[model samples]
Target: MTSDRMTPEVLWSMGRIGTFNVSPDGNTAVYTVTYYSVEQNKSHSVIYVLNLNSKAQTLLTTSPKSEYSPVFIKNGQKIAYLTAESGTSQLWEMNVDGTDKRQISFEKDDISEFLFSPDEKLLILIKEVETDASIAKNDSDLPKASGMVINNLMYKHWDTYVKSIPHPFVARFNGDRIEDSTDILEGEPYECPMMPFGGIEQLSWSPDSKSIAYTCRKKTGKAYAISTDSDIFLYDIATKSVKNLCKQADWTEQPCDTTMSLEHQAVNHQQKDNNVGYDQNPAFSPDGQRIAWLSMERDGYESDRTRLCVYEFATGNKTYVTEKFESGVDQFLWMPNSKNLCFSGVWHGKTQIYTTNLKGDVKPLTDEVADFSLVSLAPNGKDIFCKKHSMKQADEVYLLKGNKLEQITFENKHIYDRLTMGNVEERWVATTDGKKELCWVIYPPHFDATKKYPALLFCEGGPQSPVSQFWSYRWNFQIMAANDYIIIAPNRRGLPGFGMEWLEQISGDYSGQCMQDYLSAIDDLKKEPYVDEEHLGAVGASFGGYSVYWLAGNHDKRFKAFIAHDGIYNTQQQYVETEEMWFPNWDLKSAPWIKNAEGQMQKAFRESPHLYVDKWDTPILCIHGQRDFRIEYTQAESAFSAARLRGIPAQLLLFPDENHWVLKPQNGILWQRTFFRWLDRWLKPDNK
Candidate 1:
């Protein structure tokens, strides 16, 4: 029987594919697939290999322990991956045909990530080393401490404490057994790949395999508290020496000049103290003549535009390759020919792949409305392998052969064939200031123009990030539409894509034009004959959650209910409490209590959600995770308490183990169920 509607279970059952690497010959590709079991309430990943010629796929690894980051080595005849089969995650290798499996690295600590050298004789690995003074590297070495003695600002990160710092190590494979291991980043007070959300992309190997380029912040102790100045460093294997590739001249100790503006002086002083600005995702050219990486201008601003830069090895000069490109360059890879580079960035509400030459001439390689993440480029430089996804389909591996694109994997086909997905369309609504804002509207499944449906306006979290036409595992719109609710996601001002000016408009004044833009979109959405304006509701997470709170207080009568997940309750508190101080500092223009021109407090503090609690009368569902350090759990507690104190219907969903996002398989289902039930309670009373 054909499936009638898509449910949370079906979405969870489908395999989630990630990170593939093509063989040197480009004839085979190895990728990882993760599947979750609801009964076990856990997920495990396995590696698979696909033949590009015959489109035949074979399972390579079937270990109960999860295996990930599969890459071809030994002249494309062997594969290597990371697994915890021996307790801690260690490097494992096997033949191309899945035979002769053997463990490679036997380090006491688990290897976080590893990459093969171009010659395949050596491996570059990143592992965690205990940095906390009280914690012993080996548990048996010393008695266990009951409590952690904190000495630094970054003692605790997003979801875990700073027990260890990530360091890079080099190991040589002597054909029989791996030997000659060395820690390259031992003395430096730097974390390669930088915390929170960094992976193998932060490290790059030169074509000759003699030098490795990696990104790291040199700041230590109290200096790391307010600065995010990271730079690319080149490490030589033979000499064991490191040199900063993007270091700037000393400027921190300069006397205050009366001619310079205060803002300019402050920025220069910060950079002088921090040295190099934020640089990440280093990619070495095929010939090893130059290196390309992403660089940000300001020192303490994490939201600054990421411009692409190239550093020449011979001249020791750096040049900006994407100065004219308005959008930030997120990821890029050097072409096999070493003359061109392929990158993925947000453009007009969608992430597309583009190619740029050394001289800065850029051309769009893929212009589809869907989002595309570049996986690997063919060795011949003729085919591009990418993972593409849209609102109607989950992410699947696709091969771009010349102008023709062919889907190579059917991992999600079983789920896709049975899903009755809604019709998705992009609409532009006029804002109050005569500006047009983009919004994506997903009509309910089996939608009828003559029938009215309750609308759910989804507030995208980034405030700076866009709600692109991409598939989301957590906030899947198809499942919502299957439940007969119209989904509307608006790309308000401050969201990426429509240009930097539009993105910066909502910085200091988050509740100003951006809020009006959301309101305008809702008003325009209400004009549709199929929209049920009386039962409309709003939902958001992070910045989006902040928007929902703002709406509850100011536009309470319009939205029947509001759902804020891990939102900010008080802006002033968020500035100090958040782990990354650069975000709030850049957005608010200064620290809290700093006055603007009129001698008033910063706009961010003045427009905090906590101050307008008296006006919040609408029912609200607040969700928070205890481990969410980005936006503390107290934000949700305060919001839920305020609503209850005001005698308004309120509910709180707390996840003790989860972080900012509800990532666990069972918790994800519970979150979805709770979300739908809350909407049903207020928006669709008859259905309840």
Candidate 2:
């Protein structure tokens, strides 16, 4: 029976709330509500509109359609989004009142992601294709016209084994029906050496709708699972003419090694050529007088310190808006007046929103509000929407500086206050072997000084990811804590938010010193009150999955259980077979991507938990998504097979159709339900 003492609401809420969009007046915002039901073993998200002025809400469409990426078109009167109907996500639009909804495109393609131009005249949706032929590894043919494969050397540098989603074209919508779905880009092999079509991206449109800027990913070799180089291009719909913008700037961002991620892009070119500049996140001033884009590479490397440049169309002069070393601004938006740039930045471990003038002089808008950053600027420009999340609470959209974070909605408000943080405090910990490494730790929740409870260490995805954090009482650590488990989640090396230096710490060394750091967090937490060293457990997914394999095998007695989800067991295989074939490709450049290579063997073994499998005796639960493009299914299969051979009592759970991150509501509930069942069996909560 479900325990009355259980506060699973926190877990349900964590699975629910996420950023959707802001209203026109900025006084209101929209977000999604995701909930996981243990009984049904499912998780679902429904769109919600928040009134910051009154802390009220209105639910939008609610069904298994998985309506997502809700963007405001003309305030909230219309929302352009992608939803599932016939098993494939397609572009759809609906009015504010939730009426007049219709599917926008009939293209026989799976709509993965999309964005609406500010003017609302155009909508760009990312499309993926399926075929009878096995997905290929080499670049030979460009996906031209229809049904052709997209080729260009630019794909060579990316995570090899990308999904076969090619030949993305931009379609102009007249009302809901598309008027033009044209191939605005093509390969100019003579100079660019690329077939222009591969990954469909959100093409940036000028505020005046005169021009669109995009990057044609090109450049290959030395890495996979990531792009090597891409050059931005300009398209003028009126003249039907296209030009390569980077051809004049010729920027080259070299691969040193670091983990800074927003989206898993096909390619991001670093500006190296003095004449050529590389930029991302193009924005035209509201008046459409000037264009502003990021100069992504600073001093031969992708610096957190990037440059913001504005080009005056009338004079053709480029102005470096910010004289300071800066760029890669998050949630950036231009003021309606077009005079100031509003963006969020990380300063001393805090993510805060700041405003900068056209010249780039900056000042913080929200202060001492940890992890508070601008979410959206209302279409009408009357209010600004932001989310404030702290160590103690799951993130919530708040009305800034007006009435103390007008808690936009009431959904999960109580969970934060109801949560028992215990003596578990947050601390930044670092360890080193070759370079300075950074990690974050949350001491056991409700940690008592006298009693000893089982300790669980979580090894999260290392690249382009932060160890999962939720302000709710339902985070894994918190949930485990509710069961008298002392939990420790480490940021570990090669994590984002930290500078490039820290993120690149694990470059050629995936599991070496950093693995020890995770173990160390366990050892350190073990010494604390209410922690049991003998009952230690570890869990992770993706790269963390590799860590689980590494840990389970090397020191079988160290953990009671190791939950490895979609982990990488065979490095050599992943580099070749995984659909998002970038992981294995990139790590090989740091060292030989071989099984028993001498110089790198020690470090490789440390990173690869599967290498120590012969000695593994710990009980482990392995989970995987059947359709995962990132880590691939073989990762789970090999590890589970190895465990069975070794008689380690390893359990396996596979979800068909689920990707790297389970998106379906039911799957999400099933994941947590199954996860907790395994936990209860292995690390049974004392609370029960």
- The C-alpha lDDT values of all candidates are 0.83, 0.59
Tens digits of lDDT, candidate 2, 10-104:
45545446665766655556677776665566556677766666767788887666777776775567776667878787777787656777887
TM-score of 1: 0.95
Best by lDDT: 1
What RMSD does model 2 have?
Answer: 6.7
Model 1 over residues 350-445: C-alpha lDDT tens digits?
Answer: 888888888888888888879988888888887788889988888898988866789989998877776778999989999899989889999877
Clashing pairs in 1: none
Q: After superposition, how far is residue 469 of candidate 1 from its true place, in Å?
A: 1.7
Q: Candidate 2, overall lDDT?
A: 0.59
- List the candidates' TM-scores in order: 0.95, 0.75
